[model samples]
Target chain A: MDYGWLMFCILLASWLGVELIAKIPSQLHTPLMSGTNAISGITLIGALVALAHTHEPLTEFLGYLGVFFSIINVFGGYWVTDRMLKMFNNKNNRK
Target chain B: MNTDIFYVISSILLIHGIKLLGKTATARKGNFISAFGMALAVAATLWQHPPQNILLTLTVALTGAYIGLLMAIKVQMTAMPEMVALFNGFGGMASVAVAIIEGIKLNYIPAIYYDTLIYFSLFTICLTLVVGGITFSGSLVAYGKLSRKLPTSSINFRGQEWVDVILFVLLLLSAYMWIFTHSVWSFYMLIALSFVGGCVFVLHIGGGDMPVIISLLNSLSGVAACAAGLILFNKVLIVAGCLVGTSGLILTLIMCKAMNRPVKKVLLGGFASISKNKQKSTRGTYKPISTEDAYYILEAAQTVAIVPGYGLAVAQAQHAVKDLAQKLTDNGADVFYAIHPVAGRMPGHMNILLAEADVDYDQMTELEPSNARFGNTDVAIVVGANDVVNPAAVENPDSPLYGMPILEVFNAKTVFVLKRGQGTGFSGLENELFFKDNVRMIYGDAKATLTQLSAEFKE
Candidate 1:
């Protein structure tokens, strides 16, 4: 079983899934994006797997780079998303 | 077994995070849950092969973390959509870079299957690169325009449509060469052509269509990511990218529907010119009112509902509005703010600006909830809002905003409109609400007029 073939299947499936979700109306987009961001969090798994496979110097270097950037994207994306939501909280409790 | 457990837990967290995003109340928690999941996934992956060279990895991680922190702390809420576009663009760019690097690395490889993969990768790479590059540069321009760092007016040159067509043809030709000849130089040329095409497309669009444009760019970014995901053989990337791409396209279509415009018409340009011509033809049909007369009516109204728009945003008059509301409240008149869903420059624009001025959130009601209350109100004070309150939406079938729900402020006992002049809104459509017998226009800067009205209320 070729991992490359498996990868292609996954890509096609994902693309189809995304297209299906995209067909939803405009009003649903913000919520959908919020949902998808969480889905993208799964990329961390790939980063980890990529890191684990490489004891070699170049693979290790790329793996580390992937690890570092993935962390920022994951954590930072979530943090900012949280703050943006707070803006809509409507907590009129301001004295 | 341990890795399997981590995967299960991470996947659950991701699902939970998405659930949280469903309601406005739980959106923050949803984001945190997802973030935590991502962090867990990263940790589990890294721990599986703990960087043998730990120092370099740690340094790189810390530096990236610091810059991200700075952006989070400093970037304004109004700029959120632009930032989202920027990040999506970066993701797309990253995918293109990865595909390019992979192609170069395998340039000398011996596998026929790898050659096919290279061809597919190159095609996706160019598609994503062109789209992503345009989205990136175009979004930056949008940010600048929204922030007032760049002019918001449409930058139309003579025969611009012809130029755009030529560029599109060139881009298509270059894409063909890259696909068939496998020429790297053609790929670079395609990149340049796409970037220029993006700039021209965005420049032709007016401020009114920004939300639609942002959503479109978002879709492009998603497609780019999916393409990149293919090159990397990553299931998560493929799934996530496709979701984003498809969602974006759907959103763009919805936005087009909302504006009563076709997606093809929007993409082809010249909307601003048509709108401008419409405005010119409709000018001078109604008599304009003075500030003093407008203030007299405002002074006497028993209940007033204030509707703010992009004009109020331009004047930064939220504080003045808050002051006016307080004065109205003190004068024994009931006052509330009517906020349209897509008002101001972005979603929740009026609410955010009003919040900055310390306006109580409870006093602000969304369009649907507030529209019902407007008819009973004695006066509707329209501050810089145009199309959202336009009577044309309710009455005219040929009107640009026909069939779309509006604030129905025209039904109030008296309608007091404060505007800079008789200038049209971002949509470039004439607001028939301005010409209504019950409506009176107060011409001046919204900030100045509101301040005067506040003073009169105090007196």
Candidate 2:
């Protein structure tokens, strides 16, 4: 894996993230924050790989914790974001 | 077939999802899209590289899912800020665990596999651990403040800036030592000190600055994930983490701009002295108004604006507030909610609470429009809001909150401030709006007070 290529991906993604998120209405900022927070749990991939193909007790335990916590973040963050967005959406429909 | 294609698909979904998340009509769908993207990323990883201790991974994953679902379903709306902070903390700890495990494998795994790993992987390892450590600890402290387990004020002392600088320098030294010498002991120090650094970092900022800290820590967690992605050589983590990192950073900047504060000032400049020394900057008399009398005044008003603050959320009065707003609308008052960008404990918290209470989304307004309409408004009902409606933000330059935008509630023909006591707001600064001739104080729990006002209208 070339360091330069990894840097390239990161830079491009960052620019796109900013462009995508710009001009959001203030009412949706909380949902936006929680949504992006859920996306941060993409680290679950790293955690999954770390846990896989391993049998060493101590390292395995560490990876196990990683898997547990990232899953919680991924699931919890998305569910919370969904609930909030639902509140906003429901209110719009009634009007 | 290159399995990396899964990562590519996941990244595309995330980018598209975030774009839709920004708009009003498509936010829910966007959230679903991103969640699906996350599921794909997780499935691809598990299918491609299966965990050897299958039972252990499955057990851990199931428990996490149950707890996550429970938390989402069970949390009260008032506690949403704390819930978000807790989730951020957990996300950060997950990153830390991932980085630590990677470091452990790098240290003990066979030298042949390590040979293929670049030396820079060590740097990313340290980066992930340190940033994740800071995010985890800082977010926990934030959660404590939001939950009222810790004092919401800045715990500042003399020369707080010097302490921060010295502690930061120590963290840098430990990271540099760990990277250069590849010593596990230095690695431990880096991890330990960053956690300490995190606590010290958040403790000196006032609670009013939470919107800034939460967004900033949110950004830090993303950067941590990016570093972890580098360690695992996972493109999905890199793209997703980098996207969250940058977007969170942008949100942080927006929150700071709304408060009219520089990022460096909120991050490092101690706020205790600023808030402490500026107490009692202005003084004026206030009038108390009974809800019974207020109902009469409201019956004749043609236009009204409701400015909600953190106190409204604390009292869980959104439902009662909605009732009152509906009653006012029945009386021919054109009522709308004025939302300050930095309101409640987090961004858009009041709006969520109001929406939860069934308030029409169309009736809510943002700062600039609300401010502009206050002059034409017949009545401005401030529900347990003080600092946000404070004229001190505009007129009293000596006040600590000077130069920050406010609801300009005083611009209305008649103003009513519902307060619990005569003391200044949580920021501990005097509110000029309370002293205005047009303003009257209604003292009680905001929910009870609003309920009474609505009952008065019901008659």
Candidate 3:
């Protein structure tokens, strides 16, 4: 598969995603932003691969740092988004 | 090859998860679905690649997750913006590390590589370095401001703008030198300059514009990740990166609309802090109304609209506001909440607060819908909201917020503004709505005032 074609498809898909997101109510915007932030943590895959492929000390150090930061981004973004969303109680649950 | 099929499935799930997040009732499920997809993607990647230092990888990941979880759970709702900033910074830094690794690896490849591929790889590394560096340090500055560790006001020194331009140009120069000379020194210099450029880029932005800056940084982090994916030829990374980047860009646009400014103006910087000098003008006098008077007027109104702002968030008055709205509804008044895109510090900040109070998603109206109904509304309550409802956005061309889109609350037959004091809003701009004949100020803490007003409606 050609890399250029893949890049084009990704760009198109992303545009569609944004169109869908724009339709969401303003109430969920914060959670949506944070949720996407969590998704951006997909760099974890690249980091792990870099670590596995590289044998040099300098590359290894960079790889470990990448893995560490990627984990923080993924976990923190999702958990905080979940906690915030939890606060949004349904009206039926109201006292 | 086996992992490609799994990656495709993972990408589909990610897209599905984001789509489900559009509505209120399904948002939590959507969040979990996205996490599930992320887990699957990570597992597939590791399973296929099988890193050499597995123990170290797992150890770092576990430790990072533990610390991240603790921070997420312990942070207060008021500090959410900073929490988001920290996560974004982490994402950016991760990309930076990945880019450096890829850049080093590229050097080991034989010079026989396809010309386009080599150039593309170099360009991607440069982009990842600059964008990721900016996102990381800028987000840190934003976190500092939000947490009050750094000055909330913009910090500028003489000739700072020129310094910023020079730093940016130097960053580009270093990237160019590294590409042509393949010098490790030039690469490290590029990294250092980018980090400094990132900090200087955001330090001058005041707290008021932090929300917009945060969103922009989020987008940059995504771009950085995408560049990293390009370097690795990882399909899933590319897909996820593009999704986040586009979404963040759209969000940034919405925020600019809320502020009634162009993207260029925001990027050039200093619009938010510039408003500080225009603080208080001896505009028209405001009419103050007691709670009793406010209650009397509210009881007779056939329709009511509530406009909320950051002040409402500061006072934690969403619950009380909900109670008042319920009271108004029970009395046979049509109650609707007018939500401006930038009503709170961040996009949907007010909506999140309202949702926490269990306000039905249906009753919350947007700027356009509420504005259309304002003329028919018998009473409009401005709960600790100033800038959004300010008539100055429309009527006063000379005002800082003159062109911003504001809630047309003045069109209502009667208006009551619940505020703490006579001070200007977060933007430090005077609201001309306060002086209009139809507007009345119910000066007090938002929660207390709403509580008192709700009590008057009790049988």
Candidate with maximal TM-score:
2
Model 1, B336-384: lDDT tens digits are 9987755665544576677657677678877677888887988888888
**Steric collisions counted per model:** 4, 0, 0
Evaluate every candidate with DockQ and list the scores: 0.27, 0.85, 0.71
**Model 2 residue B349 lDDT score:** 83
How close is every model to the real structure, measured as TM-score?
A: 0.79, 0.97, 0.91
**Residue A11 displacement in candidate 3 (angstroms):** 3.3
C-alpha RMSD of each candidate structure in angstroms: 4.9, 1.8, 2.9
Ranking by TM-score: 2, 3, 1
Q: Give candidate 1 regions above 4 Å deviation.
A: A1-77, A90-95, B1-12, B44-61, B78-81, B108-115, B276-296, B330-332, B355-373, B392-406, B429-432
When only chain A is evaluated, what TM-score does every model earn? 0.60, 0.93, 0.86
Candidates ranked by DockQ: 2, 3, 1
Residues B1-459 of candidate 2: C-alpha lDDT, one tens digit per residue: 555998789888888899999998999999999999888888888889988878878999999989998999999988988888888888888889888887776666444454435467778888998899999999999999999999988788778778888988888888887666656788788889889988988887687788888898888889989989988888989889899899999999999999888998888634556665746655778899999999899999999899898889889999888999989988888999999998888888887888889887778899999999998999899987777788888998877778988889899999988888887776767778887899999998989999999999878
Q: Is the docking of candidate 2 incorrect, acceptable, medium or high quality?
A: high
